[model samples]
Target: MAIIKLSVTERRRLSAFFTCLVLAFAAWIITVLSNPKPYVVKEVLEFRNTPQKRAFRPLQSDTVNVTINGTGWDMLFSKMNSAYKAITIDLHTLESKSYVVLSSQKDQINSKRESDQQIIAFNPDTLYFDFSNRKEKRVPVHLISAVRYQRQFFQSGPVTLNPAYVIINGPASVIDKITSWNTDTLKLDSIDESVVTRINMQPVKEGNLSLYPKNIQASIPVDEFTEKVLEIPVRVLNGRNIGEVKIFPQKVKVTFTTSLSRYAEVDEDFFEATADLDLWKKNGYKTLPVVFSKIPDYCHIIKIEPRNIDFIVKE
Candidate 1:
């Protein structure tokens, strides 16, 4: 086998070329690390391990400013395109604490760091929170309806709700103060049959509170009703130095319509028909309309036997 060897002059030239290549690479790295630039970024604060029996509400702010320091090469080569970032805070260590000082531990504030970039500082050095004891309570629900019943239709009884009350769980400061909850506004016109629908509860828009069963079933009991005539007595009063006023009829036949369930509840005693004598004293009108009051909500007034009454003052 024959061996090929370079001349001494050629060997020295090749060695110098290799040395210059290594020197250029070393100088580039040294320049990159020598200078560090600062940049500011914002991130959301995410809380972790929140106590099951307590809620921590932000009293100051929910965002923190982060100051990062990194080399020029690190900034260009690393992944700095993170659009979203969150600083998760562990609450198990807080333990019924109102507030805590942040920046105490670098591990607490976690985020994406590009290359050799390091977090220099945070805008908020401390975090403030309001802690409250959690509680559960049962509160009644009310329905808000804009219903126009048919000509001969009415509500049989109170509107029945699938769940009479909702079990609410939240901070004692909020749960203990709530007595009842109402549903969203419902509109129904010319309703002649039963209505059933699911409605959302009024949300707790403020404070640290939670509502169970965000939506509930609502049922309205509707049925056909008949008209009934009742003889209600009339009373004339407010006569002072105006002499005894005698109404032509002492009783009036009041006609009203009510559902079958509430038909028995409607009677003459539940109605008030009166002829104010003050009208005769002021203008001396012989015929005056009888004012009817105390009409039951379940019953709709159909008509009165005699809308107007004739009266004579006996001096």
Candidate 2:
């Protein structure tokens, strides 16, 4: 390193030069921070005061683009920390089937805004809405969950929903057409056990309809399953029983599959295997298809061996 020395007068001049530069920079920064600027942004509008039985279709946009003016520092701070409320437009006093000008009610809209940012002007400068009464009804909430088992596991019972039904309310014309509401699709790939969770409903934008309960508790019951074979006896009914009739085969081998919980409960008592006498008499066929009646839920019938039995009238 090389050492260099300067006179006291030269050092003072250099220090003063640096001091003036610092002062000038500080003044310029203050001017820029204090100056007010305009920012074009969109503000949300919330509708309120409508009849409980009626729903309005929002024909106009629910947001307005406006020019807001404020100091840069204040604007930046507000942008980071300011929480704005949706501008409310009351439709309680307004009549149905009529157009209400939002520009005329700009003061009412401004009154609802709590932000300190000054809105210079609205971009469209005009707003209107066509309000109408909605139709309402109670409909079933259908839960749709696509689930797959990991292997040898199956749903033991029906998929249950905490809130099975939701109130569907909207325009009368639109509501009349809606019979059922469906929830969001749920998928469980290779599910090995039972699961219970909260799921949200699908938003119905058609006809501006709304569901009272937007979410529900879904439960999918699952259990390990095994194949079960039940040997159900085949009984001849109706015409065959009326006359002296003999069936070539008296018993049938019924094979089925069911969940482990229900494996033992499923026996001959839970189901009925019958050969309808009327069907035999009407068709006059040598063999008739066996009809299994009152099968238990969650029980899957796999194979019915010797599905038909030959019958002959005894002298």
Candidate 3:
């Protein structure tokens, strides 16, 4: 391959143009090197939950460290000044019975005064909050679901709950306007007895609502119960035994309906209505004494069709 060479005049013009280009580039570099861009050194404000062992308070004062950066003229232009902004700490996200370190730095801070400049490195990357005020509040709890009852014989009573309320407190902005708390949905498919369960409390947010104690203690007592058909065994008590006495229907039959709640306390043999078997035997087979059985204090024999019957003795 043959190399093409520039002519004498062409070479001279090209050389001059090259020299000018190099000089322009060198001038640009010098300008940039001599005057650097301006920057600011503001405090890296980090907040910590003070009373380190105890829970964090809503209001507290935190310390901050500020520094500077960039050219002297840039600093003069910046007019370094302290920055202040409303920082919000949400307590709702914190775990129950837990502590956390939250912080807020100047997200977008520019020096308002001259002679202020940013530093490449910030002073004290973290800040400590001297939290002092401890606050707590009683929050109301509301029920949301209905528990279903079991079979026809079973009955569902009013739902009962222990410590139906909770208390929460935090920053004013986070604690103000908290409405109410609710438990998870309760479903009773086919329960005959009382039911108990531990449910998580859901918080209602009206306005920034914050919770101090994250986990709420819950207790539900389920009553194990079932309906029972207790047969009241009628027995003859405190009556003269007549020899060779004849009685019709040796045992009086009684039927009644009651709650399974009182089933355990019910004693069919205790229910009794006096029947004069001796009187019947002497009266030539007259009306016999009919007795009913005793039942639990809370239960009642709603219906007793036949209170008395004729007594006959077999000879």
Winning model by lDDT: 1
TM-score of 1: 0.52
Q: Compare candidates 2 and 3 on lDDT and give the better one.
A: 2
Overall local distance difference test of candidate 1? 0.77
Q: Which stretches of candidate 3 lie over 4 Å from their true place?
A: 1-135, 153-162, 170-180, 204-208, 212-258, 263-315
Model 1 spans > 4 angstroms off? 1-56, 60-94, 99-127, 132-139, 146-152, 166-179, 186-191, 196-198, 212-217, 226-231, 237-245, 253-255, 260-270, 276-289, 305-315
Clashes of each: 0, 5, 38
Residue-level lDDT for 96 in candidate 1: 58
Pairs that collide in candidate 2 are 134-171, 134-172, 135-170, 135-171, 135-172
**Quick one: RMSD of model 1?**
14.4
lDDT (10s digit) by residue, model 2, range 189-278: 988889998888998664346678889999988888878777787777785346587776777778877888877777788878988767
Model 3, span 1-315: residue lDDT tens: 999899999999999999999999998866764576544433323332323223343232333334544554554544554454223333433333343333232332333323334333333443223233345578776655555655443332344555666776554444455566676665557665555665566643322234434334433333434444444434554344544544444454455544555556655555665555555545654565465544543344554435556544544
- Best of the candidates, TM-score: 2
Residue 284 in candidate 3, Cα distance off native in Å: 56
RMSD of 3: 19.9
Deviation of model 2 at 312, angstroms:
2.2
Off by over 4 Å in 2: 1-53, 58-97, 100-135, 240-242
User: lDDT per model, in order?
Assistant: 0.77, 0.74, 0.48
